[model samples]
Target: METKKGNFSNDNTMESIQKLTEQDAKTFLNLIYAILKDNEIPSEKLISQVLSVYEKKIPRLVKARQDNN
Candidate 1:
């Protein structure tokens, strides 16, 4: 039983959104670390702030991904 709405299906769940595989997590962390290093902003506080922003923007990100798919 699946319902569709604007390119999104009801099959999606919070657990799916929150779950990241170990390799994916490592890659994400590496990318973030590289960006911070390249931009000379390597601070734990900055990382926390960036994560906060990411969390805030997740809804928009999901919509954008759905639109793309």
Candidate 2:
């Protein structure tokens, strides 16, 4: 699931997203939606960047899930 230059592949992105809680997952998707809505970036190219941020945020949500557990 790893990639060069700290980039994330789609599979890695989905795996990271699956580790989040329901609410956190919803929030994550919402953030992506907001980015697409508010930015001038083209949808095709922006997907990778969105996935990168989504993957990066997974650790925090995972930590919070573990803490709550």
Candidate 3:
């Protein structure tokens, strides 16, 4: 099987998840839940801020999943 590039693969997502602190991971889960449940768009700035924080703490794999989605 061919390995998928970019954010589409599970490997990337797992890497990101591994980098998050418990609190950060919780926040990320909540954010994703809210978006999916409410069909709302979070503020761009808020998303950017979260991403900035995650970029530093999270693994590239996890970041890739978030980026892909």
TM-scores of all predicted structures: 0.36, 0.59, 0.43
lDDT for each candidate structure = 0.49, 0.72, 0.55
Off by over 4 Å in 3: 1-8, 39-69
Segments in model 1 whose C-alpha atoms lie over 4 Å from true places = 1-18, 40-69
lDDT at residue 54 of model 2 (Cα atoms): 68
Across 1-69, the per-residue lDDT of candidate 2 in tens digits comes to: 557776567776777677877888788778878777867888777887676666666755676778899
In candidate 3 the C-alpha lDDT for residue 23 amounts to 83
lDDT measured at residue 68 in model 1 versus the true structure, 0 to 100: 77
Q: To one decimal, what is the Cα RMSD in angstroms of model 3 from the true structure?
A: 9.3
Off by over 4 Å in 2: 42-45, 67-69
Report the C-alpha lDDT of model 3 over 1-69, residue by residue, as the tens digit. Answer: 114432224554455677666887888777656554653546775565455444433554355667777
**Higher lDDT: candidate 1 or 2?**
2
User: In terms of TM-score, which candidate is strongest?
Assistant: 2
What is the lDDT, from 0 to 100, of the residue 51 in candidate 1? 57
